[model samples]
Target: MQGSASSDFDSIPEVALSRIWQEGWLAPELRTTSGERVSVIYRGVWTHAHGPDFRDALVDIGGRIVSGAVELHRRSSDWRKHGHDADPAYDAVALHLVLCDDAHPPLRHRDGRPIPTVELVGFLSAPLDDLVARTGFVELGAIGHGACLPTLAGERELDVRAALREKGWERLFAKQLRFQQELSAFPPAEVLYRGFLDMLGLSANRQGMARLSELLPVTTVERTAADGGSKAVTALLLGCAGFLPLSPGEQALAGLTPAESAEVDQRWDVLRQHWRLRPLPSYSWTLDRVRPANHPVRRLAGFAGLVSGCAPDGLLARFSELLGEAPAAWETWLSSANPPFGSARKRQIQTNLFAPFAYAYAEVQGQHGLVDWVAALWEQLPGAVDDSVAKRTLRQIVGERRFPIRRALDEQGLHQIHHQGCAQLRCFECPIAELAMRYEQPVLYHVDEGIRQLQEEIGHEASHRLREG
Candidate 1:
């Protein structure tokens, strides 16, 4: 693909053109033939290998940051001529560049997946070879990170906290808006049940859990509840969730006691008669890199226990009543759950799921006072036990002073600043970024030993992790 240009745009060597892309010479916002914007973050190191022209490139296509290979071709069909079209090695390619769209249709992978192709013909004004000759490759780390740190270092401490608080409110309203949309269609009970299941899924299996909630609704599961013992509850829920082992070996049964195993099997039989629907595919649950206790089986058991314990009031009522009560009340119920959902997990669920829905429920029922109350409680409540974004933001803004945010609202606020501000590298618009601008050079900051230094500096660290049983 990298050869002398063949009559498409004069005889320009592609080696020079490849350097144009690798060094970020083209407009930062590249326009594809299909007219979508492609923003280059890191153009990646040029490779002399047999594959893509560039490797390890980071690009922002449609807001999602993609890291992969970038291929450059004089003509779109060169992809096929070079055998890259059918090569599995290029499977991770994120971008394809061509001088012209002389080929009838856009380029596709060997597997027939359409690769994003951007035509450089219209964007190219001067000859690329001249541009390459004029400008040498950009120096190391030209695309710098933490653009706002230099400015934020000189600001008063109180101003920064106030800005964070304001950003936190922005995050709350953003979440509330999303929850309002979710609640618009489904009934309160249906929405609440789905939300809880989705919460239990955490980051990995939220979609699977949501699907399970939809397939086996509260009404459907309510019909199956006779006594709804913990063993029976876990069996029914896990069976439906597709977490129950299809063929249990000794290793599969390692975590459960013999009594628990017998109880689950016995309860599963009862569920077989009441629940007539087929179980979901075993692959529906996420297991890779998941801790044992936080696995779908245990979360399902906890969900079943919560539903069984709070049945008469219904899941919605029990959950709603709990939000208004003390935080200890939520932890108390979590403590006795079938597989016992840890307090750390409960806090994540409470902040992400309950906070939004609680406000939405109150708003729908015309309880303005309740809506106000939920907002107040959300700000004071503790956030997730651990949030990666919070740690990242802390490192970005925290120069010498350690920024420790324990409250849910404060933590959520930092997330907004990170996503909207830091991720975008919008140093000027970001409130903290303004402070960072005071210095000509950005403050040098690094996450010291994974937030360990920050924890020691603040003298407070949430060290609670639910280890595998």
Candidate 2:
């Protein structure tokens, strides 16, 4: 039943929309007894529709263009509510999109033919729902933290590593594309600077990072014309970010060097100019719970140092080269000390990882690397289990369920078999046996041949002890 007048179909969450499709709530126009189409977009595969400009579109299914969407919506009546019926703009609507078939009397195509409606619910099954329910959460923090623990067994490591690498690369490229897109209009150097700041800001503290990013550009513009001076650059960056209000301790250190002290004075004036031109917190950047290493200021300073030291074009290539090395090498590069600066100034630069590989990856790789890293970490450090028995039991239970276990588990489970007891002689409920034999045995009979032999030997030893007594 529909709720009060305020219930609007457009308000549905994207997750719910996807679920509706999964659940077969929307009927596809091209459905057979076999199955339904995965999705229906207005523009089909050939059409080059840009974001927010949903004019003529082609729809796709399984990577092929199935049809063209002249019109799309959460419900059929949306066509009329949005006044598409009267507007000539919607005359090309080829498919009607809806979450449910709740449209009145159905709708027709512009050619006096009946437009096929796609309801999303028909494909979703109960098992799929269970799987989704297990994974989806309104709050990310609420997701079970222990879900990744199965990857820790020796058998699972390679599987886990492979998954991490694949996903990580995806995140990296996606982020790189986005950075390129954002910087399409700016000069290469400015583009790189903006991207570096954005990577530093990231999703953790959006407002603070944005504020710093906007100011950095303005400062850069001023510094370029101000004779390419380091003093000017330093002053502009520090002052624009509102960090010019040096603490008394910082002031005392600055006073120790007359040249540095004068630069600080010039920086203070730039800071004043920055405040006058831009509204306070123009970027709306926030610093809530941000670590010193992750701070936007540290990242900006680091970027400033990098730009001051190296050519912009070479930075990304150098970063990629560094990342191609072993993880230990990367750690060393990141932890190395700054080239040289005043004691007080050196402290600021040293806060960020020296190599800036992570930040570079963030700018270039983006979510792909982040997600892959998280996945890899998950595999390396899986959570606790009751025992080998419990591990084997879980492997069997999961196997019997016939669900898609992640790739990490497939490798880890196989690896366990080479090292642990076999299924015949181990405990039924034990995970070790299940893992050793590839999840064939149930909880009741998870033993190995070695374990059976040991049991016989133990029985003889017990009988001898009894006879002696």
Candidate 3:
């Protein structure tokens, strides 16, 4: 490794170069050969493996900031020798760091996004001692997931919130159109029941739930509501889902109380004979990676209670009337407690099921005011409660910063962006990425200090979790 002297520029080892970044000399005030100053943040989580030398680093060129993997080389053209331009794994690279400056400022990944190149020619400096610190945390791995600080930093939180709200409203209407398509084949009542039951699957098993709804049919449940109440409908759903216990003592139904387990067994026995229909076999129910609360049986019970209480008119009508009032109006609306759908899950149902269908109903009837009111109600509901998706994506973008999601609409927007933008790398269509592209200075990260502060504030639990995620 060469010393970080001016004469030693060409011979600087890649590791010594990394020390210069870790020390923050290459972070600010470095200019491209075209005389445009560059700013960088989160020199990126260092990688000892192949592919990009740095993953998820943020870089600012002129006024725009971008985030992605970063490749380091002894010379600008080494990337060509390495053939990274043809590699899909390097497609997300935000910046390319090289020791020697070259004419090629625009590098294209195999996927076609142009990568920004910044040579540390005028930025490197002599270290006070032999470069000994391992630069950034090599062992801790990626602290956060995406480099979104630069993207989100360019705008006011209000603007981001507004964009998120708009996206959410847009999604609401999109759902309306999708629900309307269902309206063409089935009655509105059947469509409403289908919407409610499908969400029981909670993304993973939604198709499975929808299939079960078809097998039992909401019409058949309505027929039994008078004689058997919710218990009969629950029996029908659970039996059809193949989730009914073969025995009261079955381990699969272990969480249920003895009485409740007996009820499931008793109900299934009577319903099995009454319908003379064979269950889909337990194999039909998807339990893989499923949480207990969202298990198909519990969700079926939850829907059964709603269905049993459903007005003689229809579920759509009930939901429409409920949506017209404040969220608190339905406080005691649901009565299933085996696995209680708490306040968060209740709000989740409102956002995912109630709001969209309410808006759809309003549109079909030309109730513009109801449409606006439902949108307003949607705005007030809290953002998604689970930390699963937003936390992961937001951490990747913002790094150790607090998760930026606030409104339920915002969480939906994040999901939309993640699905539509980040996954497809459609930065041009993404507001966040578009904002990042205009940033004068990408969020510059002081890796050593940031780590110290993050650890000091939340301690090792967060860091350990951050790495684990």
Say which candidate scores most in TM-score: 3
lDDT, candidate 1, 1-469, per-residue tens:
1222546343444555676676665665877777778888888877644578889999887777889999887677766656675678888789888786666676777777778888775555456545645554222111124233534434465666677778888877877777788778878888888878888888788878877887787776654553675566667777776655433432142346666767776777767666675678867877798886677776776677777787666777777778768466766766767567877688877777777788888888889999988888877788641668877776667644555567777677788888886775443346665444443243433322323454665543221110000
- Candidate closer to the true structure by lDDT (higher is better), 1 or 2: 1
Count of clashing pairs, candidate 2: 59
- Candidate number that wins on lDDT, 1 or 3: 1
TM-score against native, each model: 0.61, 0.39, 0.62
Candidate 2: stretches off by over 4 Å:
1-152, 183-185, 202-204, 218-228, 249-262, 268-299, 311-469
Candidate 2 lDDT over 1-469, as tens digits, reads 1331224444443334333333343334444222435455544322212111133456664456644443444566665555555555555655554545655766654556555565433433333334334334121110111122233333464443443334334433444455456545554445555544554565465566566666556334344324444444455555566655555543443232455646655655765575554423524645567555555445444444444433333444444455445244434433432222323222212122212224333445454665455344334322232235435544543333323433333333433431332332122222332342352232223223333455577865433332211
Give the Cα lDDT of each candidate: 0.67, 0.42, 0.64
Off by over 4 Å in 1: 1-147, 150-155, 245-256, 426-429, 438-469
Tell me the deviation in Å of residue 306 in model 3: 2.4
**Root-mean-square deviation (CA) per prediction:** 13.5, 19.1, 13.4
TM-score of 1: 0.61
Backbone steric clashes in candidate 1, count: 6
